[model samples]
Target: MPKEREWLTFYDWARTYGNYFYLSILGQPILVLNTHDVVSDLLEKRSGIYSSRPRLVMAGDLVGFDQAIALMPYSERFRQLRRLIQRELNAKALEKYWPLHEQESRELAKNLISHPTEMQSYIRHYAGSVILKVTYGYQTQPKDDPFLLLAEKVMQAFSMASQPGAWLVDLVPWLRYLPSWSPGAGFQSTAKKWSDLHMQVINGPYDWAMRNQGLPALAKPNFVSTVINQTDADLTEEEQSLLLWSSASLFGGGADTTVAALSSFFLAMALYPGVQQRGYTEIQKVVGKDRLPSVSDRKHLPYVECIMYEVLRWNPVTPLGVPHMLVEADVYEGYHIPAKTIIMPNIWAMLHEPSIFPEPHSFLPERFVGNEAAVKEVSVAFGFGRRACPGVAFAESSMFVAIATALSTVIIANARDMQGKDITREVPYKTGTISHPPAFTCSLTPRDGAELLSIRT
Candidate 1:
């Protein structure tokens, strides 16, 4: 297996081995689901057995991310956490946060205008700020906020720790018991440091929310506040722990993924000037320059919606999504999948499948325009069945408003070299658990009537 960009390897193998294939690494069974059909059949059709998560010793057990919803096993505890999270993040419940999304979208535009060169950092800040506000009602400082910094640290730790086959302890669970003085025990020290940071991120924001209970009556209730209000003043220990870690899990589940999608959005605009112009024209026609685009305007602006869909399909947030564990052996097509097998849905391959999406490598939003049937396939980027991201409604709203607002206020173009030539000629994206475009030069200049950037809620 290739160390990095394993999705590409999986995509290649899918063509050779048909839809699905199995591999045994040190006696651990692994299943790689490559096609949309195979993924839908197993992950969606038979979700009960395919929804559990395999344990990652480094990320889950050592760094203590097992408490997070993404890493939790399929059990009563997992169900409870999912229910609590979904209660606040579901589509109907998300309507009240439209102003929050629009407010942050305006903030993102302002940040880009002030510091255009730091697009990636500002985008990360935008994502972090929204999730922080929604989860904890903790507003982020303009630059280098402590909470944002803490979230970034946890993401870095998660990306490294949760990587499949990265840590020997995952393959050999017994190695976790090795003494620190022993050889190859270096991971123990690293896990210790990450574990400390993980605890800080988990506790800091929730504690802040608990202490700041004297907000004005008019203040919009956030996830933490809303959940607290749902119950009596006195809470059980399990409820408190669930609220804290579930809120922390919001950052892990939502922020980084949004950053990746938006970063890809900028890259897509810079590379494909024609697509950018088309999107801009659609926004201008549907949503005039009088004000910024609202989430409600999304339905009317179909092309802009297409552009958002294309960004997700162009390079998914997670090439190979969080692996699911198979509970109890199952048989499909005479093939036996053993219990406890790690099932990896090759999301990249499904998005790029030629039969489903012709000219898959190209960034074309028209593929989704007027094709309701095809648009459903793009949801594969999120995940399948019970394990699908709970924040889909929130994520989609954030992306639409950001895309429409950016198109309206600023011009996203390739930065010019000394010779006045476009600096970024290739469409290159960085490889990781979450795929993102490597930092590249881009010029974001204000458009006509740029005063619209000052959007008041």
Candidate 2:
């Protein structure tokens, strides 16, 4: 009830009143689940009645994202689109994309060697390029690209719309019908402008590929052409429109979250030089510098895997797992849960459990090694139930390839000051539905004999 950061608020609430609590905000009943067991029981076990999303009038309907599967309500359409995405991004399917992952991530490492200060941009390019290539078969030159700029635009709208009580129209549905100039009804203009931007962001790459008409010669079959140009494709106009939205959602889901996770990875590397050194030693043992780290090496390199898990647990991008709406009334632990009640998982608190992670706030990949029960789970970072992130396999593989390749090639240390002393700044991260580190500086010197993974590899 007090005015504190959401993480602090959720953590405090969980610690004081146990892992579950109920409250009313803006006349809406809300349930927050913080522990792993309760979340597993309700969101995962009773998924049949907990898969729908609460109404997001401002962020989804007004900002024109309702059609995106990530925001779409649970329905036949969402199920179909999710199946399509899973087909292309599931664990087995993601193997085909490994070459692209390897290429882009190595490119990021090379770019960092020359421009260490621009590490953040390089991470964005790697993620955006991979998703765009897979979803639309479009290659992004990236510099001054309007589409890249749109990713920033998406984040701005996303951050604003996700903030509770930020827009009055969300609370009062009738305000949506108010004229653009009406008093106490400015959300109309905001929605209209964002709607146009959202459309362009989703459709731009597909439009470019269509107009180019040389899509057939591209390196691979992208989601856009593969679906719209199918011999069996006889879609109604509405079906086709939804298909377009679904294709874009692939990039929407992967790009920002990947950026956040990767940025956090860098911050982790910077703050813990000893950890980086230890990880580098493991990399050399498993993956020789003759070639970059590949997915094939994941099994042999347990420390690398531990680092990946630790990064996700240490600072998950989605602190409060995406809100879900109850489809029917249910009872849990003797408490009544009414239909339509909003459910949110306090992912931050669960991931930060002091019992599991001894020094919950500390960065220690070793906590995940040799002990499953002693360590907090990392899969929850992807969410839970039928509405869980469909891009989990694809996203995990993307971050893995990127972090593994980058770590193998670079010495990521805290940047040095003009006087030649090590400079350490307090790590600061932005809080929202999507979390990310603010701009921070780091040093990336090439490792011994660490040439770029040969282009021909």
Candidate 3:
């Protein structure tokens, strides 16, 4: 079994061995790619064979049934789903939703100022609301909004099922034949419940919008409503359910990752004040204290952009990335990789490779400044190959805007310890399928009166 200490385990293995290493976990062949060259070579160059997903027998059989695009093989259906997502979430489409992102971000700033102690929850709410609005054309107002609650529960179930040791049925497919009354059967039941509830929430709003399609366009556009009401097709009920679930998948896949990345940004800022100061100074000089930053300003704000890159590299949210499967047998460096073999790009190792990143443990954004090649290397944190996150444009814009606004307006400080010293280091993290820093306290004080007003406005 893989050890519970995720980064430490991967780091020790990568430092002892070189870039690519293999391990047998629960009778499954697992390959870990630790270097940039190998990751690029396999996931990018050989994408034709490396873009498939490893089979999750339990999750696939009981829950997705090849419906979830993220877990589906590179087939026609996958292509169609990817195309739909691209049309809805690509750069151009994302621009259409900038107003929503901007509005919610402003709300985020206001919430943070009023209740700084609830920063994590507010950040989560903001991200969820943005994604929900884009996907379902609705906003989550209260903290306990039903849609948000369902989305969170579904995500929790997914996270649990995705973990390495979560299910023995994954290792031994024969165990799946056992009766529901048997031990470990709860996972099966929970999987069905999650799947059913997910379909309900995803399809309910879509159906309602379709019935109301003749009305004027909604003040807030929703992807699901647009697709359902606009597209001229005789889609089967199953197909419609699948489409809705796919859109919901975006909410599940995207919200937590974006929120965690932002959280890591704050942690990096608190731990590395010098880098934070440099970013603040750059944003202050370039953007001034007058208005909020926008996507167009990214080019002029390279230093702040580098800080974003460094945060991604410092602690990637999807450390193992969505695992890719090989469709055809292949060989590399005298190693025989068979068809249907599961491959994992050990992104943690790649980003932390000592030779690639000097003082790999430290947070250093300067290395990315004025270095085009370094910036490209950092982009690998999002994964590689054909299945790379299609939401990259949206994610990058959101992070860039949030980071810029925070740096330009607020002072992110570490909470003091009982001994009157900085207690940022005292904060720890919980290990899981998606790596997240444990909740920590930080003070977001306004830099000055003008900045405070700017944030509020």
In order, candidate lDDTs are 0.87, 0.78, 0.74
Note each model's CA RMSD in angstroms: 2.1, 2.7, 3.0
Regions more than 4 Å wrong, model 3: 184-186, 204-219, 225-242, 415-428, 449-457
lDDT of 1 by residue, 1-457 (tens): 5687899888888779988999988888999999889998999999999999998998888999888888888889888888999989889999999999999999999889889988889999999989888888888889989988988888878877887888889989999999999999999999999999989988988888888866642235689889888897777998998888778878789888999999889888887889988988998898787888889999999999999999999899998999999999999999988999999999989899888789999889999988886799999988888989888989999999999889888889875443556656455566667777666658999988668777453
What's the TM for model 1?
A: 0.96
> If scored against the real structure, what TM-score would every candidate get?
0.96, 0.93, 0.90
lDDT (C-alpha) at residue 182 in model 3:
90
The candidate 1 region of ten consecutive residues with least summed lDDT is 416-425
Which run of 10 residues does model 2 get worst, by summed lDDT? 416-425
In candidate 3, how many Å is residue 320 off? 0.6
Best by lDDT: 1
Residue-level lDDT of model 3, residues 1-457, one tens digit each, is 5646455676677768767777776678877787779888888999989998877866676666346666777887787777778777878777877767766776777677778788888888877888877777765765777776666666666665665545778777787787888987766787788778667666655565556555654435778766765568866876676566668566666788888888888878878888889988887788776777766788899999988888898888877776788899899988898787778777777777766778877889887878777778777777787888778888888888778777766778885433545655435545655777766767887665334544454
User: By lDDT, is 1 or 3 better?
Assistant: 1
| Better candidate by lDDT, 1 or 2 | 1
Question: Which residue ranges in model 2 land beyond 4 Å of their true spot?
Answer: 1-4, 212-217, 228-235, 373-376, 415-426, 454-457
Report how far off residue 317 is in candidate 2 (Å): 0.6
lDDT of 2 by residue, 254-338 (tens): 8888888998888889888888888889988877767778876777888878888888988888888778889899998799988
Identify the leading candidate in terms of TM-score: 1
